[model samples]
Target: MALAHILIVEDDAEISGPLERFLRINGLATTAIASAEDAASVLASDEIDLVLLDLMLPGEDGLALCRRLSAANGPRIIMLTALSEPTDRVVGLELGADDYICKPFDLRELLARIRAVLRRPLPAQGRPRQTEAAYRFSGFAFFPQRRFLRSPAGLRVPLTGAEADLLLAFCQHPREVLSRDTLISLTRGEGFAIAVRSVDILVSRLRRKLANDDLAAEIIRTVRSDGYVFQPRVLAE
Candidate 1:
């Protein structure tokens, strides 16, 4: 396997310099840019496997950039923020970041996160059968390969990366109640340190997106003390 290419988007040279040197020394290809404006150009020119994005930037903030890049399916984003609040982390995840690390973090931990995110299989890759690429559930079509969701009326619904992962997990195991921990593991992989509350937030977001008057029945039903279940029948194709 080729070494994963990392793009470090940080304004502070003191941080970006060491980060670049450490990742390169650890056998990964890296490119460091100070401003978010330069980010578009670099991403356009290179096949960046992952991005270490700083939350605070000169023009466009990391959250905004994450939203934009994620919509384009450009690269896997791991937000780097000085804010340690749980809400901050949740916001980052909701904005489509694959993962996040608070600033003043250990280099080893960051490296581990990078490897973990890279190890998580992307929707477009590693599927043995092409038929598994799309899933149909209750008039909703989920195309995992393209990370797209189409409503019953043939309208396109935008989904974040985390939302897509969670919805895919539900579609794959419809009518089965998945515990919070199990859902986290299935969507984020093992060793990811995400709170169970985050799962609730994700579920709420998905429910809102999947809601409509025509589809009055709840597609995802809460199991009281347990996690939740995809109530609708799903056909994988």
Candidate 2:
């Protein structure tokens, strides 16, 4: 298999240097850029599988760059920010980032997120037949290949990488109540004990995006002791 190319877009030499070196040591091809413009140039020239984007750039901000990248076909982005606020993370997710990592992070944690993102089977590369290309569940249509969701009202719902992975995990095993430990291990591609709150956070975000704010049980339902379940009748396409 070809080495996955990664682009590191950060103005801080301290952060970017370590990131580049670590990725290289792990068998990934990496290009580090000091500014958003340089990052864009690298993106235009390379086949980057993933991007590590700093929120505070010299010229164009990370949010603006994220929007621009999302508008076109681009690499999966993992936003790097000093901001640890939930709102900040949610905003990044809404803007199409695959994941977000706060500053003063562990290299191992970042590697876990990278592995999780890469583990997602891209439909363009052809996935297993057991996993459907598209699924219709209740009034929501899920296209795993595109990481998209459509409501009954025909409005499109955006999904972050983590959200998509969680949903896909559940959909792949419908009606089964997955344990929190199993969820963390499976969805994250790491056995590290992540806060169960993170799973709750992703579920909450998906529920809101799916218009299940009232807790109507439109799609996902949380069990008291077990875990969450994809409640809709799923039809494979």
Candidate maximizing TM-score:
1
Scored by lDDT, the top model is 1
Residue 113 Cα positional deviation in candidate 1, in Å, after optimal superposition: 1.9
Identify the runs in model 2 with alpha carbons over 4 angstroms from their true place: 71-73, 85-87, 123-132, 153-155, 212-217
**Per-residue lDDT tens digits of candidate 1, residues 70-162?**
887767899999999998998898889988899899999898888877776565532365555789988999997667899999999988777
| lDDT, residue 224, model 2 | 89
Stretches of candidate 1 exceeding 4 Å from the true structure = 123-132
16-50: candidate 2 lDDT, tens digit per residue = 89989998898888899888889877877777888
* TM-score of each predicted structure versus truth: 0.91, 0.81
Q: Count the backbone clashes (under 3 Å) in each candidate.
A: 0, 0
- The positional error of residue 145 in candidate 2, measured at the CA in angstroms, is 1.7
In model 1, which range of ten residues has the least summed lDDT? 123-132
- Score each candidate by Cα lDDT: 0.87, 0.79
